[model samples]
Target: MGGFRSRSESGRTGSGDKGHDKGQDNRKRQGGNRGGGRGGNKGYERRSESHRREHDNARRRIGSGDRVRDIVFEVLRKVSTDAAFANIALPAALREQKIHGRDAAFATELTYGTLRMQGLLDAVIAEAAGRPVDKIDAVVLDALRLGAYQILRTRVDDHAAVDTTVELVKANGEAKASGFTNGVLRTLTRTPAETWESRVTAKVTDPVARLALQTSHPTWIAEAFNAALGGTPDAPATELADALAADDARPVVHLAARPGQMSGEELALVTGGDEGRWSPYAVYLPEGDPGDLDPVRDGLAGVQDEGSQLIALAMLRAEVADDHGRWLDLCSGPGGKTAFLASWAMGDRATVDAVEPAAHRAKLVRTATSGLPARVHEGDGRRLAEIRGLDMPVSPEGDGFDRVLVDAPCTGLGALRRRPEARWRKTPADVAELVPLQKDLLRSALKATRPGGIVVYSTCSPHPAETRDVVRAVADQTGAVIEDATALFPDLVESGTLDSAPFVQLWPHRHGTDAMFFAMLRVTA
Candidate 1:
């Protein structure tokens, strides 16, 4: 990451001030192309401009010879050293490098694919290197990983994957390690991917460990899914394996149409995507970037997972005894759910008070709900029961919100497809660290909600400790009654596979959505 600074298109060319001045002088000597209209200068101008433009283009193309590899390597190195998120860092790097179309798509696939299969790749790398990967230089290891991914997963010519990887190593000033990289990747291409996978997973005696290597998930996370899904005696082993496989596959981009901003059909029609099956507001983009759409640019729609949209919609779908129309999003930073709730509340002449501790995220909430009936409060949501005044008037009763949503933060294991490096980044200890904050946020949300009102507790993880354990612990302390939350999504719960009663866990494999857990509670006096 130290060597890798994002280079702009201009910087890639290795252009100098002298070159710029010379091009300017050439332009002046040749006269203008369109305006001058001088007989001889016209031909001269066209030649001058064409030559100058080609020279500029050549400069831009200098360091960009093997662009796809360079982009992938840069992203991989950053993820390794800076601990940067690939989803966020890759796009910015691609834009800075001016990569688009098929090239951008290739770069994206290579980067995400490489990161996702790093564990499996490393196993094979160690076999090929005949030494532990830990002993290998980090830069060289990155090159080997990228090369291994191409040879194993992609259809790139085996020779090109190895040759370009060696070239990439040399480009990074690791000339001595190029021979080592070549040896490893060439050996990688010699074996079929299936053979390599079998060889890597052969010695894993633990079922969970074997599955983890096969699916490229950490052993603990795979175990967590098994426990969460197999809480009942009837759960099958294949269900957990399928869920892990789904996490490794490419995820379709889901777009949410803001209420009164756009319709799902309209979003699909505009973006050439299809309507999502689960949520009314969801539009599924099969592939490509969502930011390119007009509705997204205009704030009429946004990139949100369908499962997330379902949880937000459940707040409106919940049959509250008294609909106070005041909603509270206790942890409303980076407000995807808050925006959904706010959009629906505006139609009902209600308002939403979104509380976030971070000021920047509060600003993001404001921007997401810009012209909607949402008021963003920059304060700790744990004290949401106390904050009375927001942008709108206060309720006569204290914090009397009819519906409250606590989308408490967790390890984000459910979004592994979108966040390829998450599996390696998260640990079992992280789950322990998150539970207290998650419980506090849920408790505060319950406190701020009105009696007989609905409180939706959710997380983007399926860990039993975070989902059921936290809910049951809080219920025991607060004496809140768990509602039939599954009834809220009747269509999805038809098979009863997704219905865990009082709670709903949507799986990537089962529901084609993230493993989002939702539990609805009714506050009692």
Candidate 2:
């Protein structure tokens, strides 16, 4: 997302985060405009009148043309009106607005933070406005979300946050709604975020709903994460809150140093990053534009989640009998895993065939594996077995790939950290809609694998409907043997199992990785 903060600000503890509001900080925030700034109480009546006039005067400063806030508002507007992803939209907005340094950091925080905490922000906005957020105009609501986020969360002075946002609304052609925006934000400034949390969730009685409010997640997402952690609907797992909070936290970038080209330690030293805890090839980027680094630009290494690296690592480690040096990435796109696989496969003189139906993503796969012995095929993965003329080996002993990967597409629930606003964009219906394709892809992968071959089915989601359930049905239907995939990473998955099933679900809280689900299947028939 290109978000950065001063090392000092980044290193500070959570006391400075949302809802803490220390006494010193509050006094600093007020700018001597509220609470006991007067020489005398003046019997409370006069004090209240005096405070209101001064507050209005402060709000009148407008503070317009704040390029940082303007960048954030533009990103939010794109995300709201055009459904643009914040990470993609933010960097472009920053460059187009020519914002950099702390100003860029402020814009990044406001963009990501507001979107990440959108659930809670909208709840507070609703109560303050005495109406549902949907009742407000979309463009106007974007301005309000920005203002409320700054006032309630960041250390931006209350009046500056309000005044700048009122101008932002006017600049966005919502001059009429500027009054409504100002009134709503002024109402919000009266209470601290701690009190507002209680006010927003006062009537929400469900345990899942309460967790959602507390953690700024949609209730269903919290419930889904809870279920993936072994809780039932409306109930929470023991670690549910911790899991959601970890997912809600800002994620550090992980880069995979392409095998045979660079080692993790060498990359870490050169890039000023740290070697990752689990994956041998993983490097944790402390903070910087990875594109500015040589390794990334030269394709010696690429940005990928350590959890994602594990998916390819497990495939490499899985035992395949009479290996034929042929591998298939059944749904490779944006090619992170495919590149990782091809880099490792180079040592064995192996070839990789990648299938991606989208033309644009197919180009990404091609570019990501440019110098590698990988083939890119733009077609549905479900037709892999039927595409007979595609030059794959058919050894009569059992003609199919020795190893197959079905990184099936799903709702991407596990990757909420990278895309802050996605939780609000997803729905239970999305999981339901994707389940059939997930099963179909897994079934195709199993069919495309020869006897004694291994097929790894994975998703960047822990939702049961997309992970264990899909693997279970395909394995049962195909009579494939289920291997305890947790054994592949015994040190990483200390629990040895997920809900006692022979599958691995790496979580953000437990592994500090995306909630990736892995199931390794062996074809015995």
Candidate 3:
């Protein structure tokens, strides 16, 4: 019967089956049925779905300039009208807009750059714009600022800059005003404004005023740094200009391994570098996705700066011995240093209590120390001495903590590279305003520490009023002995006069790190 079967029947039973099997094999090769089991099909479907979503997201971001501009405009409007801090509002805007990658980078540059050069851009706009810049509608003013930044500073082509900015105005229901924006930007392109120096020299008579205007810094701040550097004839201009023009680049992300939780070698695998020479627990990484590293993702290590790690290590070394005792971080908020202190105190019988005045900022302290063991208190540091006196269990041996860190809040002059807007916003009055608070905080931190215990006062600023002056006044008022931080970190310290009163001042112009100030004081019996 098989031999007598028709050709169609033979084909269906043999060739037809082979053809069907080949088709299935090809489908499997194309990732259609490679996951053949029930579980495999579900997994394959999920991965394929994720890829399609990612593709769609990329497509959405491609022509997202208008949306980005609108969001940025809203942020700028809020900052101007509501007196919002641009740093705080910009992040929220970016998150709300769901902007990422190149779009995020562009928005960041546009917003920050426009704000940073607002004074100059406004002056130019005032000249080019027919209406007074301030008198123009807020939205229109922002449009002009954005357009001015592109035309004057960025490499964006003149026509695109004008057209995009005009489109932004038109989209906001100012279709009639597009011609106005167009004409102003066209005139601006034809005659770009002179450099900041020319404008400063033309406007200001005093050299300090000229420097401040040119650099976009407050004149008083320029004067303060000048005085702090011993008032050299040219020091004011040099230091002020350097501070303002210093690397506006984003800071490097640093990582430190938690004791027992991770080793420096382990962090090295994450940061792609060996442990820092000055700080064995510190790992330096060039900017990248920190979440990609297993140790970071697992919370075995944290992102911290080498300088901050060094500061914490310096405090640890300042203790007469590595014996376990209570440690306090006064004014610990957005707690980067407090986290390091917790890691350093991990194995020892040492315990750390980080105090932050603001509830929200205190939450940051808790979050930073989440993986580590540390006690976070949300209260005024000024009252901490009394509170701890009541709550802390007194050892039969003596008083409270073995060491204290009063990282006082100040004008963040040293961290301008990290906070680009800060250089322009800070004034000498801001420095003056912080001195009393710093003094109070220092006195409280000193009172909280046991006799013979160390208190390290630190600020991410180079201002004398916030640094040497505060330390000097405190040392004169109390029986605290000044210790030389440079003597402790010889490799990191710059050669300077010890008569400068035994403090460490790291300058960005000199040292590679943020301009940090440190003073180690010890209370004597």
Candidate 4:
């Protein structure tokens, strides 16, 4: 494992500026006041040691082994053990635990940070424990990750981080591992965050491994990001570190100003956000919960990444020689793009047929597109030929849909920043397993499109196998013409990148959007 050594293995935990003794000296010099950090900040990792100590001391005075950490650990447990999503699980947990204001913000950072840095956390933990992270008990591991995140990346004091984690593990019946947990964290505290970055990556000579260890991403993911940036796994990626770093940072929340209902400017004024760079219907929420906004609650606006809005907007902008009123959103679920599509379709005198195999998500699509000219069909888009209840529109010659969006279910590599725990959960096997399904959906989508109609193939992933390969396979098989999808996007899209590719790929590092890939195909007439 690429991480600093533990006391048990190396007989020393190493040292640096924020090491235990120096950090304690700083806290003492500040007289241990407990007012500087009541809540967390966007830059919690970089806060001064004394400032973090005051934050920890304030928590200690109010509630040690408290609700904030309890909530964070619970969310981590759910994510690691139950595969629950942090974004959804965290809000419910915060509400249930009655953690709000600064504490809620604190919990959010700790939870997302712990999950985001899991790979590095595990490596550090394995070194600190002198064993593979896989050997640690699940509950113990969760507690350790929470504590390690605070110790390595937050303003929480080293002592507070260690003690609270020990208390948490004991409270959760990991008493036997509490000592083990304590020793590991204590060993971790001996080094500062900056030093830890170097120590962990020192042994790894491979550029991908070094970036992976430093940025807390899986090696495969770092390699994928590098490859997407036009680098080979063996070569040093000029932008690989930046690409991976983008996932490590907190994501800016974006909202879609429902087409025909409200404009981006109107939504920005209501929510105190800014208009997005690309999609005219996109608004960027800098801070605060979007659910609290009236527009979001009123269905006038919904949280959607700008990349997603671009997918819908790009599909609408793609040229279809003869206009038709029928459109389809294959695999539409938790329907952000579907709503945007249907809203535009409502005014264009068109109808939309959205297919979702999952029942719960189908309901979400129905809810999202309730007032629009859209119909939600609960079935597999991969079997469009046999589906009996599809309410799709046809042309005068019984032709299929004019526009189709195969926002194909993918490995979700592009949106790792939004979904914190997703990176750790996905494996190469998952990608291999999903590729066939991606091809199936694309093939079915191409087959369902009428001659001269356009089909937009997209994924929230930049993986070659998922993005280019899937589109290439389907187009090659069907003789579908791969149109220059870059032209479909507005000129405001990131410059010096993707302007020449036949498709459009938006990166978070470049475009401040999810790594969404778009390819437009015109069916042979």
Q: How many residue pairs clash in all the candidates, one count each?
A: 0, 0, 1, 0
Q: Which stretches of candidate 3 lie over 4 Å from their true place?
A: 1-65, 83-98, 129-136, 173-180, 192-197, 228-239, 263-265, 273-278, 319-324, 385-398, 423-428, 494-501
For residues 120-231, what per-residue lDDT tens digits would candidate 4 score against the true structure? 8877777666778787788888888888888877778788999999888766755546667777888888766556666667878998878788888888888877777788
For candidate 3, write residues 322-361 as lDDT tens digits: 3347888988889888887887687775778889879899
Candidate numbers, best TM-score first, in rank order:
2, 4, 1, 3
lDDT of 2: 0.82
- Which of the predicted structures, 3 or 4, would earn the higher TM-score when compared with the native? 4
The predicted structure with the larger lDDT, 1 or 3, is 1
TM-score of every candidate relative to the true structure: 0.84, 0.86, 0.77, 0.85
Question: Candidate 1, residues 32-51: lDDT per residue as tens digits?
Answer: 55455577666876896687
Worst 10 residues of 3 by lDDT: 1-10
Once model 4 is optimally superposed onto the true structure by TM-score, how far is the C-alpha of residue 456 displaced, in angstroms?
0.3
Candidate 4, lDDT over the whole model: 0.82
lDDT tens readout by residue for model 2, 1-525:
111111111121121112212434664555455447455434454766676666545543542578788778878988988999999999988888688898888888899999988888888888877778888889888888898888777788778998999898777665546667777877777666666777667778888778878788888888888878888765578888888888668888899999889999999999999999889899999799899999999999999999999999889899887898889999999999999999988998999999998999999999999999899988888887455345556765597898999999989999999998899899999999999999999888888888889999999998888888888888889899999887777666655334434887888887778989889999886
Q: What is the lDDT of residue 217 in candidate 2?
A: 85
Best by TM-score: 2
Please give the TM-score that candidate 2 achieves against the real structure. Answer: 0.86
